[model samples]
Target: MPIHNADIIRIFEEIADLLEIQQANTFRIRAYRNAARTLQSMDKDVAVLVEQHADLTQLPTIGKDLAAKIEEIVHTGQCQALTKLRQQLPASLPELLKIPGLGPKRVHALYHELDIHTPEQLLRAARDGRILALHGFGQKTVDALVRSIESHIRQKPRLKLAEAAHYAKPLAHYLQQHPGVDEVTIAGSYRRGKDTVGDIDLLVSAADSQPVMAHFTHYDEVAKVQSSGRTRASVVLKCGLQVDLRVVAKPSFGAALHYFTGSRSHNIELRRRAQQRGLKLNEYGVFRGDTQVAGATEDSVFKAVGLPWIPPELRENQGEIAAAEAGELPNLIELRHLQGDLHAHTRASDGHASLETMAAVAKQKGLRYLAITEHSQRLTVTHGLNAEQLRRQIDQINALNDTLEGITLLKGIEVDILEDGSLDLPDEVLGQLDLVIAAIHSKFHLSRQLQTERIIRAMQRPHFSILAHPTGRLLEQRDAYDVDMPRVIREARQRGCYLELNAHPERLDLLDTHCRMAKAEGVLISINSDAHHPNDFDNLTYGIGQARRGWLEKEDVLNTRSLRQVKRLLTQTL
Candidate 1:
């Protein structure tokens, strides 16, 4: 494979870890690690850098030796030094190094002195009294290592948006409390409203950089200050999450935030726009010459370059630039435009709230209508509703609607899509409900062709009103099963079924790319929170973000219609 910048950066990170295990020279090891971070964050492609400059050794933090090594790695599949080190060490050594508290010195001691190559081998050594016999490795150390390994194995790979928000909120508050700080904002993937975040980026505007930098190192949540300087600081939190903080003057703060909080592709498009207008843009500001044109606000910056202001959510560089220039960016769906939620659960399923409480909460949120979409009987573990129970629930909803002053409740069910591309509920039972959300809750490992066919078959059903979380992804936790999304959108449009832009931060399924593709196929989208509780309705902002990225207009989203219009559309579909 012809490696891209991201691929090369990952290789460098692995090389740095292996070098540390070998007890290589501290400066050389630091060089490789720094190079990896720098490459990962660079806005431009490394291949372009290599092509333009033969001596990458001349680049900052890269010398003649590392530069040559990078060039070789880019051209070929391997590096000589990395290959030689791997040959001398066990293949499992790299995996073992990922264990918390196991540094290069301890790893070398275990390999050379204890002959422990794998985590299993080390665990056995700890149990058999061999680890205690080694110098500097005592009983407490062995116990700690075992605990660390256990924690590592048990920990899930991803965190939900609500979960990540909890961590960022406190840190943002702490940074804003400093006297020198003028403003602080969280940027990057989180700011773009991604469901799960890998790391958090905080940008601050400061009257004085030194004091703010000093205060950042002393934050209570900070486990260790990784790096600090006059303009930037990086620290690892107690939760093992890394946070990067940058301080800039008030005048340049907006531009700096835009530059640092990027998906790289977004920034590239911005830079290209600047270049075409005979302007230069950087972290400082956009300038026509030495005189600054725009830097105080993102809108002003874009307008100065002859383009309309592109919303942050739409700044993913996926055709947004051209759309902005042409004055044709879609009027995206907004949170205030949603009149009802189509997917929600109560105590009838695994949800924590009851039907009455959920309905009350929805009314409080100013919603005109709400759907109680408990899981179907097939999901026994979730206490999904049986056919008889659904009848009772429908009566309850009708009674609630009669009693409630301004809000109406709809009878809804989240019917399961079976293995053979049929719904768990029969047509007669499904027809009795006001709304039906068909979802694939299991068998996600099916092949692309099979998965696409399976979903299409369900959409073909007359009672299947909406397809919930089309790809069934949980952000960093699970890769979406391969499905021909363009085809799905076409089928849904042809069959008058709605494609949901699920608002649960963890499952913003059918991501922005697929959403845009769906719109191109004339498929109407529904932005639903799939809320399990009242608080989950807050996640609607993320779904709006996804909708904006997809260039969704008011007409494109079904929820943007009035309650009467929506009800009429549903009747027409049936």
Candidate 2:
């Protein structure tokens, strides 16, 4: 197979790890690490570099010494240095080094002391009482290692948008404070508001690259500085999070951010559209016959391409390009469009915010109404409301409604769906609520057929106004419980039950594709923040992105209307 830059970089990184474990020369190992990163980030293929450039040594960070090795590896499948290192260290040792908090030094110690070379072997040792006896390793360390192993095994591979935002916000703040940084914003999956993020991307506009690069390396949150250069820097935080920062001049900042923040598919579609008009779209700027036509803002770039500006969420290239070309893109729902939050919580449930405080915060956000959708009695962990508690909450909500100035508090419950497809509360209890959000809280591992049936059955209930967090996914933590989404959408649409676009970053449950699918089926989608606290209301943007990606119009969303209109829709469904 022809080798790619990505493959070669992976090999070099493994070699560097093995070398470190072997206690090789520090500079030699660092050279390999540097070369690996440089290759990984390059736009061109490593094999192409060797084929086109006679002196591959000219490549950044790849001096004559590293160049020869790279050339050998590209032409052949392996390199002598790497092969020799593998011989000195079991190949499995390099894999072990990937575990968080376990580096080459620890790997070396574990290998020599306990003959541990694989995760399975290490786990066995930890469980069988072999790890604690080793020098510098103890009972606490063994227990932690075991827990890490279990977490690694159970954890989902993606990160929720909320979790991603947690990382992006701090980094963006840090970059903005840097002396040379003119402006900074998060881009990519984080910007689009996907439930899970593969990596956190940041774009910075700087007067000079040197100061920005200096500040990136010295950031306090950075656990390790991975790579730093004139135009870009990549770092790994203490939380095992990866952040890439790109610096561009003010003139090119917008275009660069747009290009780099792309889903590759979106960028390709944009370039293809530009090509049809005899123009070129790239990171630096959009060009027509060597003249820079658009370089500053994303809107100009789209105009230069002869299309109306598409929102970031709808930029996934899934019919969006065609829609933009035809000027048929939907007027995607916006945060300002929301008249109220239909599913929120207060201290009555697991919510930290009080009923009065939650209502006041919603009003502060310009909402005309807010629903206090505390958990039903099923979720004891969240202090779910029982009959007595529900009555008390109803009274409090009524009192708050009377006293509140700008917002009305609606009595609501996020009632759990039992295994047999029944609500946690009886029909009498459910009938008393102004809004009821039916959700599946347990038995997530049920078969797709059963899970879909479970949710579809809940939607059949006249009292169930909304289906909350349809997928039950925690970004970077768990996969969506298996469910027949198409069937669920069809059934929900048929029954007039709204499918929720949960705004929680960790659970943007109605993902873009699902949202599009639901829209296609004529299902009404509700973009809800599902805010547990006031600050979480910010996540509404993520939900809006999903709605936009689905090509949802203002009319398609139930919450986009005024408070009276929303209440009317809810009543009609009831």
Candidate 3:
């Protein structure tokens, strides 16, 4: 029943999409989109803000009109404006937008021209050769759309890591506060910090099981109780995330945690090892011929098989066991080792916060430096800075740096990589900044060869320092554009340019496998927040999880270096 920030953002975004389809004022549609973005980056809950009598208008880019809508939605769970727009348009037409390669313009044309309102209709139209007759729809586009829509329908619901945490963390805390509950751990992919998770597995160690199960089933967010038992239960949260809880004795807690927080293959391999050692391992404990030898803790389970405790993120059966046995397991990079963020935005571009606010938050978070990478002129929708604007921002950063302490703001730009494989901004302008983060804003549907070459060519530019969101993926909404990443990684190594592991939850860009490849090629990765707001800096944890999954270490990350070292490395790229 609670209206979460995600809920509010979702509604606002739908309103924007519907407005766009209706050919409404560009500014009005953009206002809703901007407000949605502000909500997405906000750290606090909107309901809590309302409860605290906080002014919604105070939020960045949120105006009086948008604030009223937030209040309406938070209090009533629906927005009249959004409802009105839905009535004006075919309600099912919005569903079409979820399909990849189907944007507002394409959907609008399909709706008016073909009366296609759903994936079923669109698929039929495509099959009947009706879609290709539309202005922008071609045979390739039709084929891609059919594949995307079919795949979208077949895919199971999953939550991004950050989205899952919204439910998982609070639920864990709730269970921890229950009477007799001692320890609570969320296992499964959530513990492993997978980019996306199917469900949350909660393990609670308690003196009694009834209290834990009762408390979990009655939690405010439990929308449906799938199953309930004395020591175990399964429920679906209001946010549509399924949670399974198991109560275990304190002594068997670690074994349970290890078993539940597993990559199935990892557990299979561990069990095989235990069998070789003439021991048995499971959720309950480790046993030697029915005489319980170890299981009180995960360390004991691993120790019984002569191994050290492996971090959950690395428990993918991806050579982690062999590495642990050889004592070659990497001392994975932690959040504390990060010294700075090399890619961020401010009000100078599409980012919600100001330079001062972002810098202060970065400093507050213990960062020594934060780069202010505004979008370059090519990205007009973001109101990207031209040469003059960038020069002024660079000057502003310099002035701010002189007046500040503890944190230095680096001048930079997330310059667009033109289709012809050139940096968006001219070299003379780019030379004025501390770093240049090249990104692809348009033309995501390029061939793998061209896409890879486009990025590699951009990296060859003298001032290009890092590739932002190398794959340009938007989690569930879109797939990564075709690109030969191995070639890109190798090119980065040869060019002395770096690759970014974008920390933003929606775009944890460097795939784990790609991160591993980058590391092996001696190409350092910058685990940057690509932050648009101050709180966006908190997304670094997701990036850290991804880095660990990729087996990256402190030495392999770029921003983990001292400010001086980072500067030296950027110069090397130049």
Candidate 4:
């Protein structure tokens, strides 16, 4: 636990990087960066000064406040201000500075103007000509960036859907407003609600293809116009997301959407259906021996193939064709079906907001209940709460619940499951809460059998409620640790506990496929936004998308139930 001068320098420099990304006051940002330099040059260690009760303010750029912060980091191996800023932004964002062309100002511009947050996003932008679109970046800069990101993400690809949407929505609206553009619909895997989209496909219907294509290629965010034609155009947004736009006639709009908004297998199955009926199905229209049969509506397209219109999320050909034939397509879970969020946080942990603020936002978001599941001790980096602090938080939640209306706060702890399969908090303390969300914060390198047993043993423990972020993956930043997922899902069924479909865009754990496995096993899944801030509750949208993709119905979702039902279910786990 020795806090070396290098440690202070690194922390100071990171503080500067984070502040620069936020576009914070220049002088304050420079002070941290300068102090990091000051420490780098100092012959003596700052730790020894703290040990000897020496005055740090005497050092250059080390004011009283910063000196105290350094002392805090030295003593506890953390700084409160640093921890708070990290919670406010994406944890991996500062790492972007490691890329060749990304300086602090460019980082701010990329984040504020484009919503680019990760090295993968940066890489995607560079390849798609987005980075070169910046005001000061040249081909040389973007080229180097491409090299860095390519090297950074050699093992990672595909930006998350939420990241893709940051670029897709605005561009769609931009084209929708152009005169003569009749309809604008985003298609492809984006339309299918896949967790990650390789690219965005957009379909537009208009009488004049020229103006539509012109508008699309000339979009303000376009980094490069790869191709342009009378009816089709391809461009890369500055954010590195590729968008393909096709301007079809109003007559072919529905069929175009159906064909373009497809999983290839699903489209093939539809073609087979049309061929069986002696018709042809294509993007232009459906025809029988060259006689137009259906061309104007999606329902018409489905009707031409003797089937009902299927929801885009279910168009993966995963029994949906047969399900539609039998009138058994699932009434998939929607955002509105959720009545509560079983996991969230407040400033008492690494979260940015207060308990009341998070509660108010949850109520605004139409939730009947919000579980304040702050991280328990063991995640020292998060300043996770200890037993006494947790007991105090329980009392605080009870007091707030008494005065609140329309929404209740459930007391819960996102306690870490130790490597040996023991819960971080004593069972006595954990038993007092309304729920316990057992999680694995470390030992990600454990063997598959060890990891699987670690989780199963935790589930078997008394009062274990939900297994949070079961695979412990962080999207592009990290891989899901080795574990036997089928055994984990099957074990949850026997333990009478539930699994969390963590809705954090970065960690949408319980992958859609695992969700189906759990559903088949009759284990209900709780789609909770492991929200650190109030705005994070919006992540539930992504969670619902994942659930629908997994073919989960409302009955299979834990938070979709009434609070009374949820409580009864929680009680059964005890």
RMSD of each: 17.9, 16.4, 1.6, 14.0
| Model 2 segments more than 4 A misplaced | 1-159, 178-180, 288-290
Name every residue pair that clashes in candidate 4: 125-240, 130-238
Considering TM-score, where higher is better, how would the candidates rank from best to worst? 3, 4, 1, 2
The sequence of per-residue lDDT tens digits that candidate 1 reaches over residues 1-574 is 3334555664676677788877778667767765764454344556677777666754445677778878887788578887787788897887676675576788888899978888888778877788887787767667877776776566654445545665676778888999889999998777876666778889999879999988888887688899999899999876667889999998888788788778789898888878988999988899988999888776777777888877777777777788887888888777888898888888677665777877887888778888889999998867888888888888888887788877788788999998788998888888888878999888776778999999998888878888989998765444576688888988887888788899876677768888888788888788887876566666677788778767788788887777788887776555
TM-score of each: 0.72, 0.70, 0.97, 0.76
Q: What stretches of model 4 exceed 4 Å from their correct place?
A: 1-157
Expressed as tens digits, the lDDT of each residue in 1-574 for candidate 3 is: 7778888888998998998888889989999988877777666778899888898888878899999989999899899998988888888888888788888888889998888898888888888899888887777878888899888778787888887776788789888888789999999999998999999999999988997789999998899999999999999987788999999998788889999999999999999999998889999889899788888889988998999999999999999999999999999999999999999889888888888999999999999999999998988988999999999998898999999999998888999999999988889999988899999989999889999889888988989999999999988777899999999999998998999999888888899999999999999999999887777788898999999999999999999999999999998877
Span of ten consecutive residues with least summed lDDT in model 1: 36-45
TM-score winner: 3
Sorted by lDDT, highest first, which candidate order results? 3, 4, 2, 1
lDDT of 2: 0.78
Q: Please report, in order, the local distance difference test score of every candidate based on alpha carbons.
A: 0.78, 0.78, 0.90, 0.86
Candidates 3 and 4, the one with greater TM-score: 3
**Clash counts for the predictions, in order:** 0, 2, 0, 2
Q: Say which candidate scores most in lDDT.
A: 3
Q: In model 3, how many backbone clashes occur? A: 0
Residue pairs with colliding backbones in model 3 are: none
